[model samples]
Target: MSLSLVLLFLNFFTPQFNEAGQAKLEKMVKDRDALTAQWKASESQKSGIFGNRTKKDMIETNEWLERIIKKDNLIMDELRMIGDIETITATQTGDDYKAIAFKQEKDVQALKRAVAERDKQLKEKLSERRTFEWISLILFLISLGLGFVVYKKVIKP
Candidate 1:
């Protein structure tokens, strides 16, 4: 289970996940280039019509502009769709990361609680040991005092 989690974590950093993204980006660039070229061609055509200054020339120029605008709108729509897909993928990846981070945080908290419990037990044992030592010392001193009293009263008197 942990191994799978590690692999899932590593998968995000790999190029395979980005391959689809790279392709989408390339498509967008190509479409942009094509749109630019079309725009330039339309501009050149409109410029050529300037010298004539006739009603027919104006109509033709307007028509060309209209067609260019329509094509531009279509290209913009495509770009927008690509952007939406990228946004969704990013959101999903972010969610995955958040889940993994939350799990790791929970694990850390559990380990900290275990360590605190162990430390508390150790402290209790240390306190008990100190109490036992104090009691033993008091008993030993009492026995020595009693032996000295016996020597003075029985042997000396």
Candidate 2:
């Protein structure tokens, strides 16, 4: 029964891991598409600015540059969100695809933060499990010793 319970828990965790990973991957892809679109729009505006350079053209180019900056900021923000989601998801599943997704989500700096957070959380969980195992072992040994003493005093020959 204990084995079955542990297996069931493992099975339960598997889907959550996969689901989290898939959702993050999809979001990353969406951000990539958004970045591409923003890049194309910025390029078009840049071409327009270069085509005609006058006072009016300077004002238009300034507006175009502002739009480009806004688009760049949007891409940066989406990349950040995608990084966070991928990091959280990767910690759940040791899938290499998660690393790919992280790369697709953002640049190396973002990936570093994601990896660090994932590793930190994993270390904390492992530490907790180790502590729990030690505590359980101590309790089990004390209980066994107490039972042995009771048996010798009350029921032994």
| lDDT agreement with native, every candidate | 0.72, 0.68
Off by over 4 Å in 2: 1-106
Measured on C-alpha atoms, candidate 2 has an lDDT of: 0.68
Candidate 1 weakest ten by summed lDDT: 43-52
Output the lDDT of residue 84, model 2. 73
Clashes of each: 0, 0
lDDT of 2 by residue, 15-129 (tens): 6765765676576667656656655554544334448445654565566667656666765676676567557545645554465567667887888899999999999999999
> Which residue pairs clash in candidate 1?
none
Best by lDDT: 1
Question: TM-scores of all models?
Answer: 0.57, 0.33
Candidate 2, residue 94: the lDDT equals: 51
lDDT for model 1: 0.72
| Cα lDDT, model 1, residue 11 | 62
